[model samples]
Target: MAELSADAAWNYVYCQGWNRDLQRFVGLLDSDTACARNEAGEQYSVTLLRGGVPRVVIDIAWSAHYLGVWTLDEALRRDSHVDYRRLRAEQLFPVRERVWRYAEGQRDGDDDVWEQEVSRKANGWMSTSKRPRGRLGGSSRTAGQEDDTDIWREVPVFGDWRWALPDKEAGPVGTAAEHTGEYEAVSAGSPWRPPTPYRNLYLDDLMLEGATVLMEGAQPRVVAHRLRGMVDMPTGQVITCEPRWLDYSEPFTDTIEPGRYEVHDVLLTDPDSESDWWPRAGFLLRVSEAPVVSWEMALRAGEDPRTLSDGDFYGFSGSQGCFVDAEPLRTADHQINADRGREQSYALRKWARMAKRGELHEHPHSQWSDALERGLDDRDGIRLPGTNFNMIAYNCYYPDGSYPTWIGRATDGAIVCFLTDMRTTHPVIATDH
Candidate 1:
């Protein structure tokens, strides 16, 4: 096992989570604690500490989401090597004014249209705190320490900020080919499998040929128009493909481009509902060479509700005088629903930040570029220069909730986020590696 030096010890703790009671970031202190070897004879240990004091020890070698101890160190070394001061600092938006404007603006520009709304707090019309939670940068100070630069001076993180991809598709539906995979045939337990409509039809029956162009008219025609799956986006259409074949007998020369066409149709397969299941159901397939990366994060309030300022509110807000100031937040009545609205707000903020920093690996397609252009002012939605964390704060109307998502590297050197508001903030470690 590799011995931990001062820098190595710092890397381990810097990627872990922050300890609220300790009043400082937490991480592993020494290298000897990580000497325990797994069945593979690999040394692995993840110890979280508060001010060089051990708090929680996780044996990541044999635990879930294990990527080996060496990987953890490599990621940490890469993240810590960068001089954050040298990188261009991101500009921060005026969050308080934006949320206030949204709250004050009526549905139809009239006062009584939606009058029950109000701002949560009037404090700090602009939360200009250089650091998160009014605390100094990570690795700056410890619990009892006085000097800001006494603990450490560098911003410890894991490699350049990159988007981690999901392990599997978000949807549950699978195709016939997936059912016939080697694992599916030998698996012991049976899952509640949804029937694939095209399971009966095998690939041989479809007789799909590779790139067989049938005609070359104004709109080039193809032998088979592949109908994958459908995706629903905010502005227009988002589509997903599952290898289903659809026959495009009619001439789509007018609507489609010159390239190969992938035609899709809106289908309703819900048996439970007597009414039409395809109410406003739509199908759109937009294929682009431009790359796309997707990931998910659980968002939550990190600081005490009382300490949060007006700028903390991100997306939507209530009116200034009409709504209860702190009742919603204090009573936990304003928690953002992760599945419904939080994801949309997160994607908005994340992509905007990535684009502005020029860290986005894949060049966005025209559609995505257009969407980003529309929200350009949000380039620094919940982030500031020199701060170790990136945040995504927004509000939803129907559910009447506010979401302040915190994203940052922990002392342990993992890219993680704090989703929910507990007495202590726990890092939801990202496992894309």
Candidate 2:
């Protein structure tokens, strides 16, 4: 390909559907990846691809509604060896025809790339391929020796640990053992007591040494959910862990960190509704950036049916009365006007900062904090498109201490995303819920 000419340097702006304020605002909203997420109940089911590393699982309370999203909140990457890069491919189907550029140290180059277009029709499958030219065909990797799934993480100041996420812990905050069922109720009047401003709430980044987890055993029936950090407030330390599930009721709740912990549970919920529709990870995660925070986890199978997707973070387990959302759940009251008073971009940042400031020490209402417009937890929410576990959710809180919620919605309406195959609509009944 020869270099282009200056005459062909066509440059101009083209506007197609543009007219009034409604359309303009709608357009703005469309570009918002944030909105695509947290659209509660628009779709149900999140699937981690067959190659999803580490583990996959999430849990949202079935009774929650209004605003809930499959949130991929809070991620940070520190400089390290084994130079790595993350590519966010925006496409209708990146398996073949993609929407954007090939990221990550160039998954490929100008060199020939193999193109296999597969389709399903009736009881048969179809595949059209554009084989690579000469040596550009298959990679040098051998059978079963494909991609390397290794990661590293470093702690961040004010950042809490998150096990579920592939990142390191940031701060020292973890839930207490046993379901107190009183995180929200306790000191809802004025229960804030943050660390002193002089405290070393450094915004420094610690380097994460790369490590490996060798599973040397008969691979047990695996069930992995994202992890939340554990912090012993008494000692001001943070730790990240990946806890395994034993049974339904008494799953292992090991504290990687010692000492007593005060439960400051951060959930992915709507800002204004009674409760979120999804099963939030009960006890996990750390505070980040003083203002924002994140919560991670999924899955809780029920005995009624074993219909759980890979990384089913919010589904219930055991033989109890299990319920699934029949249709895409929807909810209002994600972030109220009061929450977004006018200044804050996200509500979580304000809430976290205030919490650290001891604002809620006496009463939640007294320490009530609100933001102008933003989420309670400010972290990049993870999302997997086209796959079954393609979920997106986020939330914000009202300083006035109302039942916090999120601005959430799902793209896969009633679709069940899981391993094995692609998306399959798994409609759940709201009545049972």
Candidate 3:
């Protein structure tokens, strides 16, 4: 129950889904506002966000040690003591286009072609922007705003960015595990009654099912949603609830390094189907790709379509696009699904003002030496970025990579990250913590 400094107030950011988790969390911090700094040497406010969003940035007088380094991989870490409630600005920040991500190859029996399904928007051939706008760096200014998806300004853009889901698995009928610890085994016999009626979002398929690994060399670990569960507040007969889960059995894009094997595969019993008895006929889920993180394997050249449950879990192609454009946004026509082709890469170009170019701090972020020696560019050779109340902008030269950074400290001296800038921009407070 902390408060913001008089100079700052909690600014509102957009919510990802229509879930009540955000609204209730807002009530917790009176809007758990945050403050963090960017390379602009200015302080801004931000609403912390979760998932593949921006790292919460606060308005700090000081920048981090890697402020002038050219490569990424040096700026990865967890948050510490900073007044997250008292934010640095309102929105979140986008990547500098240095850090990048993409879909890896599909495995045997991966029915869903994640890459092909999500490629239309990756190349910039078409779009759905009414104003022909590109990307929305979460924190925006009117006149300063233009249709520039490829442009990197250290600002938070809230548009379309997705944590590529898992590839479906081909398997036998998956069984459902009871919501085990949810309620202590009540009755000794059959009809076990409940204590206090608390509504649990225990989807029949999501109740921790068994897994079967299809890939011969793949890891057989049965990993799926890490921290799983929902929060429910009873409302008389019915209960209101919000869902949250640490689905850590994420798929990797196969950046198979030395000895470390990439983790993939999730045991999910897909719900719903044309069948009446098993209305959700596809009860079992043993996709070729492991969990989401495991699919974070090294981006390959031909990681197109893999079949799992005969359905499609979309994916994006073209390297480094995640840091800038929302690719393959949608190919088919809203009215005519058949006419749709691909989501063209909405461009986001970056060019410094005449004066700013000469003094470009090419190697602005240099904290991690190993990356420095390797000579990696901030997504697109960006140095200094733009800033505002809740964001910073990284002007991107290439639409591929992302320039990741260390978010700053808010007032009152406490640290907590509300935004996570993996690709798209803007910071909404993360409801988990």
Candidate 4:
């Protein structure tokens, strides 16, 4: 037998039959040697070599169960072909026959049969559906199944040294006092709070000067377009998305009182610069003027904000721009489609007029000119010439991407605003020094 290293021996003796152990064993073998591996990188079979000759073959079934050692010929016989019917006969058929027998005994009529069928189907569906996989430590039972103690008994390492294992205990894994200066203690009964302070920025403070626009048949002159609108949210549930892509949006679960909410577009214009494009900074949907005391991610119905992991956030998709409105607007699917068609037709007609005037020169500097030509007046909302909609729409900082929306709350717990951060420019926080 080849001498094993300390790590190799410890793993072979103490962690035998584990996927990692199998992988380590295969890694040490010659690369030309054949080995069977599952999709999960779990090695199931490998031939042991002595002087580059096959000595014995080790094999493990699914999940590393039923590990067996065999001679070269025996391993060859086992690998030659599969006997699926024999497997089903030995494993599945007996359990299924027992279940059928039990059902037949309980059967009273077609109704009983129907109930059994329904129950079986429901169980099958539930078993196959995606669910969060959690580990149960020690000798705990899972989902009414047998205690894991019995399952661990089959493991080679556990079989011989089960009594040496320490008893499970319940307590905090570590204490703040143990690392006094490294940790901060929070109140036990208080509501959960964010780790960092959220910035309370004023929309008016974000204004810039000397922004210029080049109108058709006119000189490039300085112009400032501040787009602001009030959106009615009768359903309380707020939704933001590209107005035309309302179908792709979901409502925020943290709803406010049903009422009209003010939506303001944050534009960044530099008077000193020569760029014609007055890029948008972001959009703010104000719910109250009260100073915001807390901020949370605006999650949808199915999402649990409390369970959000790092890098997880609720993002609104924007193509041309974004809209802020109530969830009730989503019910008018047909009207939305009609309005979209009308907007497309209007854009086509405007383009034709621009072409007729021989003013079709490519304006590669900015999409603002294209939006202006399409009759999207920078007034209350970016409403096309003819289409009517309740949502407040405005161009985002960049043309398209996913943007995160945050919900701010006042000291008294009332919602203050919903901020869609486009990440182009940072607004001056009122409380910042």
Candidate with maximal lDDT: 4
Candidate 2 local Cα displacement, residue 37, angstroms: 36
lDDT of 1: 0.23
User: Over the stretch 366-426, how does candidate 4's per-residue lDDT look in tens digits?
Assistant: 2323543443344454433223445666656566776777777888888888877665543
Give the Å shift of residue 108 in candidate 3: 50
lDDT of 2 by residue, 1-433 (tens): 1111223211111111111112111111121222233233121211111111102112211212111111121111111101111111111111111111222443322344333332211112223333334236663221222222222222111112142233342222232111111111121211111111110111110001121111113211111223222222222222111111111121111111223222222222323457534232122232221322221122122211112112222222221111111111111111122344455566567667777988744332232122201212323221111122111122212112112111111232221111110001112111211
User: Model 1: what TM-score?
Assistant: 0.19
Q: For model 2, how many clashes?
A: 113
> What's the TM-score of every candidate structure?
0.19, 0.16, 0.18, 0.40
Q: Cα RMSD (Å) per model?
A: 25.8, 30.1, 27.8, 21.2
Worst 10 residues of 3 by lDDT: 239-248
Clashes of 3: 150
The sequence of per-residue lDDT tens digits that candidate 3 reaches over residues 71-154 is 111122211211111112432112111212222443222333221111111122222211111122222222223343542123
Runs of candidate 2 exceeding 4 Å displacement:
1-239, 245-259, 271-433
Relative to the unseen true structure, what is the C-alpha lDDT of residue 250 in candidate 4, on a scale of 0 to 100? 78
After TM-score superposition, the amount by which residue 239's alpha carbon in candidate 2 deviates from its true location, in angstroms, is 4.3
Which candidate achieves the best TM-score against the true structure? 4
